[model samples]
Target: MSGSKKTYDTDTVVFGAGTAVIAAAIAAAKEGQETYLIEINNQIGGVMAASPGMMLGAGYPMKTSIGGFFKDYVQRMYNHTPPLARRRLSTLENLGEEVVYDPDYAIFL
Candidate 1:
C-alpha cells in the first residue's frame, strides 16, 4: 500500500450520479452536510443519459408527487425542446404521471 490514495471525510457519501443519487446528494448538501457523489461512469444520469425516450413514472397522483431536483431537471428540458414537442409532451402529461425529455440534455444538466 502507498500514500498516493486520497481520503474524503464527508457527512454524506452518495455512491452514484444517477437521478436519485444526485437528488440525495443535493438534499444532503442543502442541509449543510459535506457530501461526496461518486459515479463509476464517465457520464452522469446513468441509463437515462443514453435512453432518449426515457420517461419517469411516479406511480401516483401528480398532485402528491415528489418533485425535488428531478422535477427541476425535467422543467429545464421543457425549455430546451421546441413548441411542437412541448405540445406533444403536454398531451402525454395529461394522461399519466410521466415526463419525457431529451437524453443529451440529461447529461448536460
Candidate 2:
C-alpha cells in the first residue's frame, strides 16, 4: 500500500454529500445496493453547511411533508440536548423552523 489510492467498489455511487445525496445513498443501501457517497469538499452538506442556518419550511402550508433521512434529521435535531438546537424546532422568528447547527455535525448526521 505504497502509492496507490484507496478505492471503493459499489453498486451505486452517489455524487455529493448534500442532504439529498445522503438520503439517496441511504435509500439505495437499504435496498441492498452497495452504495457509496463522494463529495469534493472535506465537509459535507455542500452549500447548506456554508450557510448560516438551514430552513425546513413547509411549501404547502401544513401539508408540506418530509420522510426518510429528512424526517430522521428533524427528529435528531429535536432530540439535541442543547437548548439552542431544541429552540430551532419552534422559534419562527419571522421564518419557519430554521436550524443553526455546527458544521461538524454535518458529518455526524
lDDT of 2 by residue, 1-109 (tens): 6997987777999999887788899999989999888889777877656665666664636533455677677668658675224335535444456566666664465
Give the TM-scores of the predictions, in the order they appear. Answer: 0.70, 0.67
What is the lDDT, from 0 to 100, of the residue 52 in candidate 2? 52
Candidate 1 collision pairs: none
| lDDT of candidates 1 onward, in order | 0.66, 0.68
In the order shown, the candidates' Cα RMSDs to the true structure are: 3.9, 4.0
lDDT of 1 by residue, 43-75 (tens): 888777766544344355553346677667676
lDDT of 2 at 18: 84
Clashes of each: 0, 0
Instruction: Count clashing residue pairs in model 2.
Output: 0
